[model samples]
Target: MAAFRSVLNVANSAKLALSSRTMASHPLAGLLGRLNHVAIATPDLEKSANFYKSLGAKVSEAVPQKEHGVYTVFVELPNSKIELLHPFGEKSPIQAFLNKNKDGGMHHICIEVRCIDEAVKAVRDKKIRTLGEKPKIGAHGKPVMFLHPKDCGGVLIELEQE
Candidate 1:
C-alpha cells in the first residue's frame, strides 16, 4: 500500500509539472486586458442615443468616421462603454449588418490588450484570422484590429491597444 501511494504521488506530480509548462508556453496568457466596449449597430443614431439617455446613461454626440464609413456615439457606463454605430457612407461596413438587423442589435465586442502588435502575432500563430493585415486607428483613437467572426465562435471581436 505504501509503494502504491508513492507511485500515485509521482504520477500526480508529473501531471502538475506538465500542466505548468503548457500554461507557461501559451503566448496569449496575460496578453488580453479589460473589456473596452460593446458595439451596437443602429439604424437611427439619434433614437439609439435617446434610448440610452432615457435609461440615465450619459451619451456622447455622433462622431463621423469617414475612414471607417460609420458614425459613432458613445454611451458612457460606470465600468465600460456602449458604442453606437450607424452607416456613414454608401459602402459602410455596418450597412450590411444593419440590413440584416433592421431594428439595431449588438454588433461586436471590443477587448483591450497590453500590446497590439504582440497580440496580433500571437493570434496569427494560433491560426486566428484577422480582418486586416495591420491594426487601424479605431474610434477611441487607439490601434485596433478585428478578428474573423467565424474563428471566434461567430462573434466579431475587436482587440484594442491599451
Candidate 2:
C-alpha cells in the first residue's frame, strides 16, 4: 500500500539521520570489531549464579540495580561477562521480558565497544532495528541501547559503554 510505503520511507529516513548524528559523537568508533558481554534473564538470581559458578565462572557479588528494579550478578570471564538479572520490582524490565518470554533464558547480547554511539551507527547502517531512540543510562551509570532481534538475524544485541 502507498501509505505503508510512505511510513517505511519516513522510518528509514529517521534511521539515517540518527546514524549520522551518532557518528559525530561516537566514542567507541574504534572498537566495533569485537563483542563485550552477554545478559541472561532469570527469575531467581541465586540459582543462576550457582549454576554459572558450577561452570567455573568467577561471579561478582550480587549488585542491587535499584534504578532498573532488578538485582544483578555478574560472571567475569576472560573476555566477556555473563550478567544475571533477577527482577526486584513489578516495574522491572526483566519482569516485563519474562512475562513476554514465559521462561528464564538469554535476554540480550552486549558488545563492549570503546564508543557506543559509533557502534549504534554501524548497526543502523546495516539496517538493524534499534529499540531505544537514544542511549539510556543503565545500571552502574553505563549508557546502553538495544537493537531489535528481528533486524539482527534473530539475536537481541545491546550496545554499551562506560
**Candidate number with greatest lDDT:** 1
lDDT of 1 by residue, 1-162 (tens): 999999999999999999988977876668889999999999999999999999999999999999999999999999999999999999998999989988989999999999999999999999999999999999999999999999899999999999
**Clashing pairs in model 1?**
none
**How close to the true structure is residue 160 of candidate 1, measured as C-alpha lDDT?**
99
Candidate 1's error at 69, in angstroms? Answer: 0.5
Question: Using TM-score as the measure, which candidate wins?
Answer: 1
Work out the TM-score per prediction.
0.84, 0.69
Model 2, clash count? 3
Model 1 segments beyond 4 Å from truth? 1-27
Each prediction's number of clashing residue pairs? 0, 3
lDDT of 2 by residue, 1-162 (tens): 999999999999999999988886674355554566788899777888998899999988888888778888888899877888878777888898888776688988877666678777877886777887778777647888888999777888877784
